[model samples]
Target: MDIELITNILFAMVRSGTPLLLVALGEVVCEKSGVLNLGQEGMMLMGAVTGFIVALTTGSLALGVLAAMLAGVLMSALFGMIALGLRANQVATGLALTIFGAGLSAFIGADFVGKPLVGFAPIAIPVLSDIPVIGPALFQQDILVYLSLVLLVLVWLFFRVTRAGLIVKAIGENPWSAVTLGLPVLRVRWLAVAFGGALAGMGGAYLSLAYTPLWAEGMTAGRGWIALSLVVFASWRIGRILLGAWLFGLASILHLVFQGMGVDMSSNLLATLPYLATIVVLVILSSKQSRIRLMAPMSLGKPFHPAG
Candidate 1:
């Protein structure tokens, strides 16, 4: 019931949800472009370990972030190749990618285990951090938090007010029609998948270097999966993604708070809140006709023959 606890909870929601928000943002794009990058979990883990190692050794935050994004891009490209080019199953390919990424991260981080966490420092603008309770929670976060918000707004504009966005949506909606109209469906989708990889990789970097700053084996801790459901929960809208991430963040903090308060709930039950909430949101959202209209590209999970 304390004021700080609620304040801290809000702060924690923003801080914790930043990664999910980023990953969801990219996933929404990818899905809109008709590609489902299920390997987000792997992309994130690889990026996290890569970022942690690079940051620790090079003493450069930028380099660490670049390394993480690179790692994620590489992994996502692999997913794109199998799923997009060779006509493999997106769902299975994504699951395999997750396993591959997790194992690879564990192997890469083996030596880095027990090492100190390396993360970005928080930055507070003048006059912003001094605004009583609102200032500290909102403005006193690391630069990444601010960037996530910026990306959210920018992506929304991209979808709502751009020709390219329309093309991507058209491709997702009807690939054959897009092809007839002379759109580069495959190429555009490939780029979307790659961008999605980079964004999800940034999410990974947040977990290892920015959020917790520790390299744990499989440190993503189901966030990747949660991000996937978030697409449904948010109804594939960037604006709603922010709200979904915050909701998930609240669920996560609630789990911790319950534990601290000695509520005697099973650990597994507590851990299920985020996923459960996502499902509930999806159910509520599905009843709305507006949400159902945004289906993935016609060729999304379908293989692109390109010859027809």
Candidate 2:
């Protein structure tokens, strides 16, 4: 491919990856605190529909974003109440939340179907964007894209160089010990879940408000599940999450690239690439169970009972 074609592909890759990066980053933090939330897809749909409605009605993207985050937090709170508070099965609760979010979003968004709004536009950094190939792809992006990159660094630092990060890690590894040591294990996990919800919501918002700029039921198109897989694919490492998200993003957009190149492949089959990659990654990782055990949070998905 020519330089221009390569640059455009890179740009599209980053754009495609932004939502995945956001959701996966949050999942890392949530899982780090020993909570396994499978409800990210639900949270994201709630965010997307809520954001689109708020922005369309109020004509303010800022409010829309905040609303989307709030919607996600609310959905997560519901998940937490059942899974964390009531000590229900985490996996079941998460699946239920996804179903609920999907149904509710569809019901609420029925009126807004096919509606259009002005979505987020890219802003170019003057000097940096003027660079040859990489600049535009990296520097000229929508606000959410920049925020995702910044959050990636902040999250890495949060786990690497902060006391709170250590506390989260400690809780994830051994919540019983954390409680014995007088640490607030329950509270920490709750906060982690909430944070995850917020980011998931924001990821959804990016889809409706920036990525596609329209309200459509099921618009996330399994990106939420992909984000969940990405957390595993990255081995819960913050830096690896970015790499994985972008790689998946490239896979997601390959159909468009192939079509541009005049390749006569089945569009339907090409669309399956991202999901197929998810399954393949899980299979590979599952085969190396020992390695995954070493990398994953020790108490993940296990309910805690303080009275024990």
Candidate 3:
């Protein structure tokens, strides 16, 4: 393929992958703290609607992103209150959060459906962006693209270098032991959930404010679920999350390429490739029982109680 073709594919892949990367990264942190938030879809939907509404009203992309993050945080906080504070079942509460988010976002965003905002503009670094084929493909992108990469690096360092990260990991491995060690298990878990929610919201904001720039009731589609799968595909590791996101991104963009090239195939069938790919990856990863046990958070989906 020509450089132009290659660049187009690469750019599209990165754009497609960015949101997944953001969501998966946040999930890693949440899971590392023994919180399995199946509410990613709900949090993302709330973010998309809230971000689109705020940005459309204020004409400020920054505010839109902030609103989306706030929406995510609030959704996560609700999950925390139920699952952590009240000692409810994490799985059931997470599912409830998703359902609530879907309904609430649709109700709130009813008026704004189909409206389009100007959205964020791409930024090109002066010298770097001028560097031939690699420039536009790599450097000439929106702020969120770079932010995703930065987040990956920071998260890696957070897990590898920081005491707080270790504590969170320890809690995931054994919350009961963490409590015995006098660690503030519930507090740390809440914070991790908040951080995860913020990132998921940002992922949703990118969908509305950059990817498509229009309001749709379910604009997030199912990226949130894909992101959840990505966490498992990555085996809860930071570096693998980045790779897994790009792999899924490529799968997502394949349908566009097929349609563009005048391939005669059902659009619906092509659309299933990304989701199908997700299922395939999950099956493969799950089959290796020992590996999964080694990687998965031990206390994931289990409610933790200080008084118990």
TM-score result, candidate 1 = 0.92
Write down the lDDT that model 3 would get.
0.88
User: Which segments of candidate 2 are over 4 A away from where they belong?
Assistant: 263-289, 292-294
Cα lDDT, all candidates: 0.85, 0.92, 0.88
Candidate 3 lands at a TM-score of: 0.92
Which ten-residue region of model 2 has the weakest summed lDDT? Answer: 285-294
Q: RMSD for each model, in Å, please?
A: 2.3, 1.9, 2.2
lDDT of 1 by residue, 191-300 (tens): 88988899888999988888988899999988998999988787677788999898888788888887887888886787787677767766665544644564434455
- TM-score order of candidates, top first: 2, 3, 1
The better-scoring model by TM-score among 1 and 2 is 2
Tens digits of per-residue lDDT for model 3, 1-308 = 57887678878888899999999999999999999999999999999899999999998999999999999999999999999888888889989998999999999999999786887888998999878766775688898888989999999999999999999999998999999999999999999999999999999999999989987888888889999988987779899999989888877687778787788987678767666766776666565574456487878888887666
Error of 3 at 231 (Å): 0.6
Q: Pick by TM-score: which candidate is best?
A: 2
Query: Which pairs of residues collide in model 1?
Result: 172-297, 172-298
